[model samples]
Target chain A: MAQKVVEEAVVAVTEPAVLIHRIALLFSPGRHWLLLILASLPAFSLFATVLPEDRADVMYHRYDGGGVEVDGPSILVRKSVMDTVSLSANYYVDSISSASVDVVSTASPYTEERTETSLSMDYLHNKTLMSLALTKSDESDYLSETGSFSISHDMFGDLTTVSLGYSVGNDDISRNGDADFGDQVKRQNYRLSLSQILTKNTILGVGWETITDEGFLNNPYRSYRYLDPLAGNGYSYLPEVYPRTRTSNALALRLKYYLPYRAALSSEYRYFNDTWGVDANNFELAYTHPFKEKWIFDIRYRYYTQDGADFYSDLFTRRAPQTYLARDKELSSFQSHTLGLAMSYEIKPGFLQFVDRGTLNLAYDYIHFDYDDFRDLTRGGVVGEEPFYSFSANVIKAYVSIWY
Target chain B: MLTNHRLLPLVLLLALTGCAIEPWVQPYERARLADPIMSFERDPVANGFRHHVYQTREAARGAEGGGGGGCGCN
Candidate 1:
């Protein structure tokens, strides 16, 4: 179900937090090693660099799954000034309609829309590049603003690149019908990455990121069921509660190899862990093939698995059973498999006089997700003995790009 | 913490030595790498949308060189 669709008039009265702002965890002792690594990177080398191409893209995307439908349009444009600076802007919108299980269980089916706008500027100096970006997203009851900065330098005679980045986000949450309900969440992210050209035909990249969030971390409109023998259905619903703060870390390794012929192969592995007692792994492989001079084809497969959070459960024993409680399926143990295919065709220059190059692209993906702890309650089976839940989704993207 | 201190000198030594190492793959030999087929991310718009989809559905996020977080999806 789309989290953006919440038409309920229910009042979400958030209680006082058991803990105060834990934003200080960003500088915890455990992060010293990462800081030292960043400090020890080599100085930049004097190498010539050019700005990225000036281009514009128009894309339409759709996702259909779990009785929810979402379709959106995204437009991005970038331009270069002189030879040192590149500026870009993006406008994105998502229109959502949902009648998923979560909505059918305790809330009414709803429709909603969210829009996001972002702008960024990149400056290239010698072999070093600096970038700054700002983004804002607005929905009926939620608003978020984020700002980010990053720097990259080419070292070791252009054989290696090192980058550091940081971003912060502030968000405001409000209830639809309750004018008095308001909450805020603050988030910070730290990133470090390296890209190395191992050989003429091979490249490798590694990245690590730490993200910390403090404040309201749960869905205000969602509820969890607890066993209540006194009730007719043997259960009662209460607003879901969650920890006030969360911290997560992710590390990823990627490799791309150019085949001897006219093909490229890529593989990636990522590991993730969080303070909420969740661990995850993701693996992916992809291949790209170019035919003649005007067409390219791509195929990819991905697998992901994760363990449930410590407080996640299908059904709780009683009300206020634990300090933190959640039945959100996203926090449950699950695995997913994805298969994707894409094709792109280059447009002849004679077709468009002003544009230097153009391409039309189409892509599709099919994903299957299986949950280990979350169950399908609509089956009308015994409580705690219901069958596990699984679903499949189809995603499509069609886009056009032009370079001038 | 003491172990990190001891290892710092070794790391510094290794990085300093990098300057002396010659480029193994010459610029002329990078033709294959320059090809569009070898790009890690070919379509930025499509790739960005894919990332958003997964981030909204899964508990795992970040470490993919993406920034800006204003998604109400999750």
Candidate 2:
């Protein structure tokens, strides 16, 4: 025997180095030196084939007011099946066209098309996160459906985060040329959110929401006005009465900051209430900048105000009939303003070789609307000079995105 | 408005006492709070198409929350 084959080859290499030191004492301390350099790689391959991270986007929008016009196109898709899951899908379309001012003084001048679809899913664990969604919409006499759920958690280590949500909706309405006039409606929503991490460049957020509605909430081709005291001071159209039930609440606050030239600043505030006598306020401000490391820019501003809807009216100085009536200029008293701009660019990954990133975006907005007390029933009740209805609008967007 | 509902509970108790006096950040100092504009949704399909165009031109909506249904173009 050659010394008993050299002691059986040193007992087969010390029994695989004592089973890799008992699997590197079951990893800890930053994963035990990356599992001892992946067990000393030699023809390495411990199995890893995780491919997921795909995206696609497309959008186009345009809207103009006063003699309305809407335009559309939207599409989205996302994926990340695992590594904590993710998924999404969407499609939207609008294509409306009107002749506003109450559709050019009460009816006719239409073109419609509406569609929507959505689906979503998300999940993560280790401090939690969750979501689920569904939606559907259709036009030619309306239809809708919705469902949603949400959850989030992470506290005192993720510097706080909290969320909760719920949703439900169902609707079906008809009268696009009166197909036996159908109706139905229902809605519900609830939400809450919080976020912290306030310093290391700040961040803070808060939100609360609630909503509920039930049954036929008006709009069968709207119309309302009454006081036909012999028709010359003009005013006599009917078909508006609402309040089967409604409830609403909202609150929000947000802030973000970070600047050392990297740029960022944001803000938000909101408050709202509704039990039919509205009260609202909203404000927003934003700024963002980035350049050279792949361009980005943004600007924003918004402001809004509201109050009105305790049987809203702009004319209707009596002639009976009033147990809830509205001449819906979104239920009267209002104020609005918006201004926005955006830009984005980032694309470089060997020209889309399975694209690991890509983006190109553009945005614009400009809106204004003011009406202290909705008037202008096509300007016909000029007692002491009526006419207070205003409008202005423009919005445009373009998008492209890719990631894989 | 009732003194803004009594100053909204004293601004939510001074924003939860300024989140209990902040100061405790260490996860490698959260790299700019893990930027993405410190996301409160930095583009989720352009914030869901600007929240559906301000919920079809506002009449007051749930200041950024999700839910949809009921529309007669509003």
Candidate 3:
């Protein structure tokens, strides 16, 4: 049962890719011409703008916890090419240093860097909007390429909206230390969403997603341990094994309410289940308020819990391992909490000659995780004496955005 | 799968209720809804970064639409 859930989890994570592809394919040259023609029509002129807007954003992020540290910077730029068309590009980088328990117990800690680049285009034709995006990520031992497309339509005087999307991705996986090890994985995703304005102060949305994955799903460098009675209570490590294919589904509902005091409240609930025995739920709440005509303050909280995969175990008792086994802590039963706060200040227009609007934002979040079944392996091999795995992490983000 | 069977009815119920209770508001009376703060995503860049952080850390993904690639972090 756990194996089924694990498979589903892997597939579920890959669903976003499929929807992207579908949306991209939806906009061929003929459709683009048609949309352009529609945009120029006098009937639609009232809903379109004549001037283009340009914006740039720069962000920095840092994460520290569980003997692992990651810090990075990202930059994004967007420009409107036409009244109904816009383009955007982003570059992101991550520098990671890890001395986590798993690495210390079985392997040496190391530093690595990953970089990603992406480009996207969006088009709006009257009440219909469409988008296409492509992304590439590269590291020393891994590479991935992904494409996505999506479309949304507004109806009933713009009180309701529906969207559909698809994406696809291909990834090449390898281990730096093991030159001979190489594998690949393919992922696809499909998504549908509906949004409605319930009243002047309230809006609600619901979304459903499905994902499919094929090929290698396990970490090439990760291993699990099993006790060997013949070795006098000691344990031996073996490479983790996983199924090659998986499918999973997820559903989410979100709500936003505007308060009379100029504050906004938002909440979301998500439920996920997979073929492996895993079931998960997530709940989130947020509040945003504006003050002094220049500052916005926001606070959010999230709770997440999940069941373990069927084959996930901290220690295998048998001398011979099962055909498919894994001990990755993420596949274990766990619960986590996150609390976040953010503040953004807007600069008044005309503060700069060329810049129309500018905003500076800073945000921070603290996350805590507790594993119910997985244990910290840094301790000596003792069954009941092993401590349950738990860790806390902090994340910080600072960014500035400017529009011209 | 059985859990999905049970939740499907609830989802349908809520969706229907949302559609049924939607009140019509004239274009001139939509000032509140048009407020920047009322937008589902007021800042695309910030929201994208937030989504990436959550996707990499959590086991679940895909509530939002696509455009993210896989990394070895998971």
Candidate 4:
């Protein structure tokens, strides 16, 4: 019943995004090894090639008619003191020549040229609200560094607001591919927030986050080969967890409603627990309306579920596999559902200046990832060894922000 | 791991759904107004390019503000 084997594996992956709409026939090598096994990991090992001057994945795959051509360069600055303090800065840069991460398997997809940078500061007294930030990510494969701070108050006036924050990130990955889910990982997070309004229309937020992770969180370039006749290659070899350490806790809730003028309604829910034996829950919804005055409308829906990672295994393991390294994909702990539609058009092209503003946004998204413990690990290859590989993506973006 | 303590009475009964919102009190939102809503909507590089488009499609990321990217994925 796993939803009819995940709708027969997404009707068998919608016959290739509607079967060849052409982006050079959708760059295959197993769709670039499924986008290099989902963009080969490595975030806090600080893999730098000078990338981070603004690279929103090249601005959401920036203006494409296909056949791949992307260009992105971004920068931002903000300040408005007088009542208090506020300062901000952002920079992004990207240069990708995409061969889908230089195809050599182990989940390929990490074709260099990257840069990311971030800085932020905020301080406001009396009622309290504080912030400090820093981020740097450069990539040829991976590199990361992050710092964060936050504070908030207003608890006990019935309008409730409380926040406490912390962040630390470190990354290093790039020994050139072969990531079966091991290649360096370090993370630290602590957060607590509460926002309450309770009546005039429902505004609520609750959050508690705690994360402590240590070293090479796994993905050493990736691998999965099974050909067993009695371990003759029935597969089973994934040794390396790089000083693995994990602890996670999260509980989140958010709600918002307003039905006029800028019509709004929002929802969010999250629950998570971790220590290798992963468990996750996420739900989200959004509706934004603003038409005519520059037209704007947005709609969104999301749901995610997880449960897999006490060294999730598949390829027939009953007892001789306790995560001697794990990376068996079905995207581990499966369940992904998403539906989205967005539109934004705010133009102030009055020959620039007047606080130069311009925005154009269009989005369409549909996602489905489900695996009922797929378990097959290929023997005669019926696309099953736990077959469930479905992916669909679409994005369009436009930007213009000028403030001098 | 279960000191969600019955999640504090379901988070105080969902914090009574935080009574809805529409409180626009500016005069610089007083108290000097620093980071009012995460640095008053700081726009972390447009929310880090909307979080690199929600890590590759599928949308929805708290309209700018609070938390960001981390992956060991799974």
Candidate 5:
């Protein structure tokens, strides 16, 4: 009888040991263990409690640390595609004041204020994402807008993917009572991309983009200060001219690296060139780090630079009329840099504690812009110029979300 | 005044489009599929950022890939 009892105890210990070994084999240490547990909970529960599809996301942004200011609010909602295809749209209204483009001509340096709203949507499938998106903005100084459609397909057992999409739209600038002569633009774009899974933990992709635009292409709102043709004002601009047609081609590549436990590193670069003698380069990098339990953090940096169009010229140019085709900003090269940080934390949901999808997110981004000195040939002094001034703006966004 | 107002419909059209489609991934799936830093998520944000930058610096429109729709510029 004593021997029998010993054998039964051995069996009980051996069975649990086997089970533990199996679990460890499937879940590698560091982060996979946690993921397995988190991913398995829903699997074991078999979604006993479905999370509410209703969620609220909002972005309240304020820009400029000084006399120039901007404030706006935006929000988002997500519906389940499994049920009725998900939809999300955001709107924003902003008030502004600055040294630039004040339609009120009040000399207050703060007369320009505007409202802007943008909406985006997705027709979702289990494995495909088809979306049509649009954005529009109205301000005291100028009105700008665009609409687009994008599609993403998951292939190779969700490892490899392909995307093809297109967009067409226009940006019109107006103030007081007149549209910028030749300022209207009609355009269309085409895109093709290929994404490949380099490893279980890595993905790399390449893309091509093309755009063609024709029609009124003038910035009636802005001008190079020249002697007024009609009156002898200190500075007056000759009428701006529109380029009848323009085209652009861009190539881009992206890479993503997966680390332990939902952590990742991502980067991308793009090069663009146009028929009008303009060239641009873009580079971006970001890192994602997830803490124990349910907290995620993100840090990102971006750099961009673009050469001016051949037709571009500034306040004073030594070049003859042959070199000056008549667009103001087109002559000035431009560059920009951005830094961003964001975080998400999960906590108990008070209203629907029974369901398991609850998390809150906060994000902030800041950017700086400047125009480079490809300046005047005769007036050697970039001395009197501010080097295209500096613009700084920050936007903060917050969101509450749930998943089933 | 009427010509100036043509932009009004364009702005309204964009705001309306916001309701038609959404980012490929839903809010909840953001963590799993569309982390903010990922290319998929960053594309749209960068698209907007680039536009803003181009508007401020170079000529607003380029030779090739631009408009997201069929309508042409004025």
Candidate 6:
């Protein structure tokens, strides 16, 4: 029976991939295929299996930090057909304006826009739920396509759930002005997770994932600096280089408990390591409180720390000093802390004749990042002797959801 | 084949315990668990954005159950 279920899930996964492929081929570059899919959705709601609630969301998000500003709008729509199938589509965009430290010292500040679209479907078979998703992201210099499939099973009277997932992605990278500079990357991910209800008020979850990446993995425009006593700033910049392949593994544990006063508390921990010799740990704690019947408030704190990759260096002694060289801040030893707050207000039921419920939500987060090895070049005392880099960021999100 | 070997023990364990297992929390006692507050991911859209931000800013990625392609910015 288990084998049969797996086989069925695999079959279910392929169906959506084929459909999405055909849809992609049919639509022109500028045509709105998402609208076409939405128009044709009602025809599929003929099954009698349990499905997720139908809802639509519109969100606006903004992030500001380190002389960089990113803001955009995202929209998501999910609808169920009959009882057995659910489909979701999302459109997201990011408009970025950057004068960040790295860009300022080595390159000119610039503005860019990224757009992403995704389609997903879930098929329910008894206690098994199979999910398939396809996503495409496009920007001026990068294009990525990804597909994922997962199977989830509930057992032991629904007290335990297990999921297995896999995803494959392909990316094409290009330089903004250099038409001849082009590269590609391929990635694969495998994931496993288990959730168990320990008691009436407590639940536990564990997840493990592995990812492998191959091909070009570094930014074409970014450069690493090395000491050059005769140069203007005592250092000269050279194009950064990175390993051609990498593999990483991450394991996470999460727990949530209901408090006696109608509130919930949750915590999560994750450990991650990669073949590039980066090790990271993340911890988060959150509390959720509901006021009366219409309002919910949440507060969370997250801390993350990571060691530098083996090939990373804030400053090298000479040009091409290492077989693989990286000066990316994200690859350096660093720690970040985030504090987040969110509130949701439920709209009165039947606010509209066609809608069952609605909600308005706003969330804000403050993050502080400190780097141990990477220096702030803008400070400019000495090249490698400068102060460690640190910066703070603010993120805001506002969204409205309507359930039909 | 290697995956099958790894799953054999789990399959056996589940099969052995399937018959004897009884839900400790009765259906009537599950109201609290069903509350929206108990949801691991209360806001999917917001969570997705937050994860994207972290993935680009940090070297660590994955294991939070969300999967999408990368922009290669990292």
TM-score of every model versus the real structure: 0.86, 0.31, 0.82, 0.26, 0.66, 0.86
- Distance from true position, residue A35, model 2, in Å? 13
Regions of candidate 4 where Cα sits further than 4 Å from its true position: A1-205, A208-227, A230-271, A274-311, A314-353, A356-400, B1-31, B34-40, B48-74
lDDT tens digits by residue: candidate 4, A1-404: 33443333333222211111222223344444433322233211011111111112223434221122334766666554553566666667655543221123233333345677777777766456687878787876678877888778653432566778887888877654445433566787788877765553456778777778777655555554333456543443443332378777778787776554346677788877677666777788877676776766777788777776665554434334444545444226667776777676666667754444455656655556565554433223442254443333343444444332
Identify the superior model by TM-score, candidate 1 or candidate 3.
Answer: 1
Q: What is the per-residue lDDT of model 1 for residues A193-277, given as tens digits with 9 covering 90 to 100?
A: 8888899889898999988999898888888888999988788889889999999999999999998887999999999999999
Question: What TM value does the first chain of each candidate achieve?
Answer: 0.87, 0.29, 0.86, 0.28, 0.71, 0.87
The number of the candidate with the highest lDDT is: 6
* lDDT, candidate 3, at A233: 50
Docking class of 5: incorrect
- From the highest DockQ down, the ranking of the candidates is 1, 6, 3, 2, 5, 4
| Candidate number achieving the greatest DockQ relative to the actual structure | 1
Q: Report the C-alpha lDDT of model 5 over A165-208, residue by residue, as the tens digit.
A: 88776766555664443245667778877776565456677888
Instruction: Provide the clash count, candidate 2.
Output: 0
Residue pairs clashing, model 2: none
TM-score of chain A, predicted model 3, versus the true chain A, to 2 decimals: 0.86
> lDDT tens string, model 6, A9-92?
333233332222233333344544433443343322111113456789999999999898999999999987866889999999
- Please, what is the whole-model Cα lDDT of each candidate in the order they appear? 0.79, 0.72, 0.74, 0.51, 0.54, 0.82
Better of 4 and 5 by TM-score: 5
Winner of 2 and 6 under DockQ? 6
Model 6 stretches with alpha carbons more than 4 Å out: A1-50, A349-351, B1-20, B66-73
Interface RMSD, in order shown: 14.3, 16.2, 10.0, 20.4, 11.7, 11.9
For model 5, the superposed segments whose C-alpha errors exceed 4 Å read A1-55, A65-68, A81-84, A101-121, A124-127, A134-147, A170-173, A179-183, A226-236, A260-262, A318-331, A352-359, A374-395, A398-404, B1-39, B42-74
Candidate 3: regions farther than 4 A off: A1-54, A349-352, B1-23, B65-73
